[model samples]
Structure formats: structure tokens, C-alpha cells
Target: MLYSDKAPDPVGLYPHARRVGNLLFLSGVGPRKKGSKDIPGVTLDNHGNIIAYDIEQQCHAVFENVRFILEASGARWENLVDVTVYLTNMKADFATFNKIYATYFKENQPCRTTVEVNALPTPIAIELKCIAAFEDK
Candidate 1:
């Protein structure tokens, strides 16, 4: 099944998440707000050059978006089995991201992989791709 709702709409034609059997696979979720092009923490100049940003804010938004998707799919933070994090600047943001991440995942830590990349499709700092498993019927 496909899940999409008031959460940030997918930038592409894909659904926010898809469930195969018990596992729900979420598409890359960014910090962009739903029904708007604005991305949290993104500050642009008149010419669209990034003047400033807050990684912490972006991280929170991304996780909120991920949470919405997970819940919409009948899953929760505890149901997540794995997560893949994409960061535009790992060296600069990893420490901050890790701190915030720990708060959310807490003792229910799932397998995770974080990687640095040149950029995402949008001007956000972080995106999350997650997999969650629902209880078997």
C-alpha cells in the first residue's frame, strides 16, 4: 500500500511510503513543509544563494516528517528496523545530528547508516530513508 498525506508531499511522483508485507519502505524525506516549497532552516539570498541554515532545525523537521510517514503507515519509531541518513555536510553536522537523533531513537535504536553527499534534490541539509516493520497478522 502507498501512504501520502499532509506530510511534506514527495518532490517526485512517488508515494511517501510503500508497504510490502510487514515492512514499510519510506522514500527520502526532507524538511520541506507540506503544500509549500519552503524548507526549514534554509535561508536564501536575493539570487537564491544559501546565506545561512540551521542543521539542528532541519534535523528536527526531517525526523518529524519521518515520524508522520511512519505513523501513517501503521508503524512507529519502535517499529523501525533500519534508517539511512543523507547529510550534505557530515563533518559539520554529524555531531549535532547525532545528538538530536539519539533523543528520538533512545533505547530503541535501529540499524543506521549515515553518509555525506554533495547535495540533495532540495536545499535542505538532511533527508531520511527508513524501513519499518509492522506486527505480523
Candidate 2:
């Protein structure tokens, strides 16, 4: 079944998450606010060009969005087993993103893979695709 509404409306034709048995696969989540196109920590020029952005802020917003989706599906942050991060500026943002990520995962650090990309669906600097095990094997 499709899951949504706990976070912003998706930017594409996909659900927030898909469940197969006890596992939930979350789509690539970004930092856009619910019900609007505003992205946290992003500074845009008058013509809508990106002037600046804080990776840490974007990262936190993305995680919070993921948290909402997980909670709405009866899962928690600890349930996340894996995460794939996409960044537009790995060289410039990895340290900041890592620092913020450490605060969120703490003892429940899931395996992660981060990669630099050319862009995202939106103008945000980061996005996350995650998986959670909601049931014991």
C-alpha cells in the first residue's frame, strides 16, 4: 500500500513508502515543507536561483520528514536499517551532513551510502532513501 500525508506531497509519481511484509522502503525524501514549495535553509534570489543553502539544515528537515513517515507507519528511527544519501555537493557538505546525521542516528546508526549527484528533483542540496525493518525476523 502507498503511504503519504505525514510529510510533504511527493514531487514525483510515487508513494512516500512501500511495505513488503515487515520491511518498509522509503522513497527519496527531500526538505520541502508540507503544503508548500518552501525548502528549509535555502536562500533563493529574486529570479528563483539558489543563492545559498545550509546542508545541515536540509539534512535535518529530510530526516524529520522521514521520521514522520516512519511514525505514521508504526515504525521508529531505530527501525531504520539502511539509508542511501544523495548530495549535490559531497565535497563541500559531507562533514556538515555527517555531523548532523550523527546526532539523529546516535546508537542506532544504520548502514549508509552517500554519493554526490548532479541534482535532485528540487533545488535542495540533499535527499534520502531509507529502509526500515518494522518486524523481527
Measured by lDDT, the strongest candidate is: 2
List, residue by residue over 1-137, the lDDT tens digit for candidate 2.
55657699887788898889999999889998899878999998888778999887898899999999998888899999999999999899999999899989888989999999998888899999999998675
lDDT (Cα atoms) of all candidates against the true structure: 0.88, 0.90
Candidate 1 local lDDT, 1-137, one digit each (tens)? 56657588777889999988888999999988888877889998877767889999998898888888888887888999999999999999999999999999887889999999998987888999999999887
How well does candidate 2 score on lDDT at residue 4?
56
Residue 78 lDDT, candidate 1, scale 0-100: 92
- Summing lDDT over every window of 10 consecutive residues in candidate 2, give the lowest-scoring window: 1-10
Model 2 residue 51 distance off true place after TM-score fit, in angstroms? 1.1
Measured with C-alpha atoms, the lDDT of residue 99 in candidate 1 is: 96
Q: What is residue 78's positional error in candidate 2, in angstroms?
A: 0.5
Q: TM-score of model 1 relative to the true fold?
A: 0.94
lDDT for model 1 comes to 0.88
